[model samples]
Target: MKQSEFIPLTLITGFLGSGKTTIIKNLLQREELSKTAVIINEFGEIGLDHHFIETSDEDLVELSTGCLCCVMRGDLQEAIARLLTKREGGWSFDRIILETTGMADPAPIIQSLVLDKISAPKVILDRVLVTVDSVTGLKSISEFEECSRQVAFADILLLTKTDLVESVEGSLEKELMHINNNAEIFKSDFGIIDLELVLGEYKRQTIAFTENEIDKHSHSHSHSHSDIMSVSLYFKKPIHAVALTLFLELLAEVLGSDLIRLKGFVYIKEAPETPAVVHGVQHIFHPIEWHQSWPYERKETQLVLIGRNISLPWVRAILETIEEEVEETTRQNEN
Candidate 1:
């Protein structure tokens, strides 16, 4: 087996009191996260969150200097680079996780890694996990842009405090789906979630359209707030690779900031055995990865898009049109 050259870095971000630290505390106790270097940003002089995390001194690094998004960003980079140095000096760590301040927006922090020339090559961003306080989550999204943006950029969203709430289905849930349709929402009682779900490789599970169908997934809803909504598209047939690329390009050009995150596995006609994995943040998309084999016998293309101020009807129409165009061209060439 080929060992991965870069260390995987995960980001934990959410609004104030949204249980970001609570999730980290739970993750530290798991053996899966052991030998993981944790970098935490402290808002004040004392790093209270760090104290709560039970890890060795070598594995824990606290940035009590300043907020990671602002003046302390340089220090954050230095801390990560130092961790790399420690690894060379006989320290053993497989992964790194960073906890951001609740009020902070995650874009800048992500850019810090993407734009860094030196440290960028050493670490690969694995995933971003955002926690939402069920009690105050809706209120925070309504009142604060930071909270909304945090949700927008998340790969996985943990809805904490579900036990305290009378019902999980409400305006808050509707609003969350509107703002970020792409994130997989899981309910957590008190920061207790299976480590596998949190740290495992992302695999999209699709629901069948008909009861008799082998597999499928679907959701439809209307929200009072119109800024964000998740759009899910499932193709019963395999899609052409070029058509899929064009669709993503058009989306990035048109949606821009309105496009929060896009992720899903696609079955391509060109490669029947391997599924093309696609993911993008805003307009910037990461390179596609191809899985060796299908997760199951099902061979269909699936795409889930989370965007702001976009219509599902328009998205669906555009994609259908693109696939049609590709098929027509292929037919003409074959003739």
Candidate 2:
């Protein structure tokens, strides 16, 4: 909230055509992002998104960090310093959004932001927003380590193309829960999600590996990149938010070693429609945080998994039992 503190930046990443372009294009229209700057990396020779962007104020700058996972540190640090210079020169820049190339990996890009250079640190990583196609998320996860990593490392996982993925939603939902029980997953059609969800000036903190955060929900599920990776499960409605949090803590604890990342937007029996998101690294899990409001047209409990070998039956049972216990507790409270 302090204006003098450095702004929080979000890394937007996903596979090619996962609607990263579409999302960014619409995002620029948001009045909240008027002073927000964009640092986009293009893998191909010609940058297609540039044509769609109409930035007369010069807030949008293009910086190509060739092979995001490789030279991300150097390129990002230089770009941040350049941005500071530009701002000092009269053009003021507020927040930053780094749109990584489709094939990019998000971990190093996120890890690098917190680090200092010759001049200073590049920037603070407020959160990571990942765009995933409702249709191809599973396939992408099965084939690419980057896809899995992108989802795993995200603070917010935005599910794009949900209308085009009604059939696969069930499967994707299951996989999402097994991998990450903590992340808030928003399903968007036509690349629609509130800018508040995408853009935030939240203070950046490293993923903490405290015993309480990782001691519960302990399990491991991993798959080689070549395997088919997706799962879905159902739970009886109305679970206490506290129990759900406990389940996630346990889930992160068990899967922490093997988990690349975990995320979901759940409707607790206590707070329906208002979703909470969870983000975790390998063995390090952050606490669940509530969203300001629902961004999507609909609200339902849905979790998206990006890891492999995450079991359907085990996760399903775990979630169901957690809810059952929580519901019983709620019933007793009312009595």
Candidate 3:
């Protein structure tokens, strides 16, 4: 509606070892997505996924500890909304890839956007990409709710790790149909699929739905809910890098378990031109990535954490530290 067109979100989800990360990495390789912003969410810790991406824009972010559906749901919508508004020269990506935690219920995140009018400012559910590990296929169906949720909500299904098991594209197709008759399932090994096939799948589904159908679909599914929570905190002013870094270290060291993921767009005093953005999953933390320019309507620092048993009060004071409130900071320039 505004200057920015409807933001397209490509939700990538599936069970552990499903090659969801692998396929998304391939999608990043596509020339079409060279400008895409990727949110990579992992469980427990260790963020190796960001290292695998070869892009130079610093467009990749790894979310750890928290699941997107449980805690960062509203934050996700806000982040997208902020992205649409954050621009001195009209910054917009080709797409936004949201990689969910392997052990997650995708519905909460999906429903959050559909139900939350704020996220509807300039964004819509572009498509769902679910990767299934053919080796551990049927067993996951009976064992994990996360597995079923991934398949049931998908618009396009990618069958991965097929090389380990017998070639069962036909059987896998049948299994996918049983759970989600609407999605198109394809076979993949080592995440090797033609970029054409991947993007083409989304384009076809895009063509199938009229604009009115999307409004109806979003309205129809907006009433669902879950127990897990996503939370976002804001500061009147940006904080110094040293204080924020110390705060993050304490978060990972102390409240690591309750925290599934922590992502923030912070304003560091030393670097005033472009703000600092940090993505940390559980114990493993990626050093803050600085943006070349601010991309939204607000200059205030914002932090999003997704998890369980987390008390926003614990670090509320620390996160709210305005750059002016804190002492001088050593310049940590963007790479």
Candidate 3: how many backbone clashes?
Answer: 15
In candidate 2, what are the lDDT values of residues 1-335, reduced to their tens digit?
A: 34455666878888888988788878888888788788887776567666676665367666553666676667777777787788778886678888888888776676566445343323556777888888888888777767766766666778898878545466565554434444467777788788778664443222222223332323333433333233433343656788777777677767664555454566676777566665544434445677767655456555544455577577767888877787788789999
lDDT (Cα) of model 2: 0.65
C-alpha lDDT of all candidate models, in order: 0.77, 0.65, 0.64
Candidate 1 ranges beyond 4 A from true positions: 4-6, 30-32, 43-48, 54-56, 64-77, 108-122, 162-171, 199-226, 296-298, 324-335
For all candidates, what are the clash counts? 9, 24, 15
Which model scores highest in TM-score? 1
The full ranking of all candidates by lDDT, starting with the best, is 1, 2, 3
Native-to-model Cα distance after best TM-score fit, residue 45 in candidate 1, in Å: 6.9
Q: In angstroms, how far off is 178's CA in candidate 2?
A: 2.2
Top-scoring candidate (lDDT)? 1
Model 3 sits at a Cα RMSD from the real structure of 17.2
RMSD of each: 4.1, 10.2, 17.2
Report the error of model 3 at residue 271, Å: 57
Per-model TM-score on C-alpha atoms: 0.80, 0.62, 0.55
- Please, what are the lDDT tens digits per residue for candidate 3 over residues 1-335? 56355666778889887887778778788777777878777665676666766665446656665677787776676666555554324665756788888887776676665455665444655677888888777677657767866776666788888788777645455555544444567788878766654455353221122335433533443332221223455554656777777778777777755555555577776787787876544444455678777755567666655454555565676555523344533334331
Considering TM-score, which of the candidate structures 1 and 3 is the better prediction for this target? 1
> Which residue pairs overlap in candidate 1's backbone?
178-228, 178-229, 181-230, 206-216, 207-216, 207-217, 208-215, 208-216, 227-309
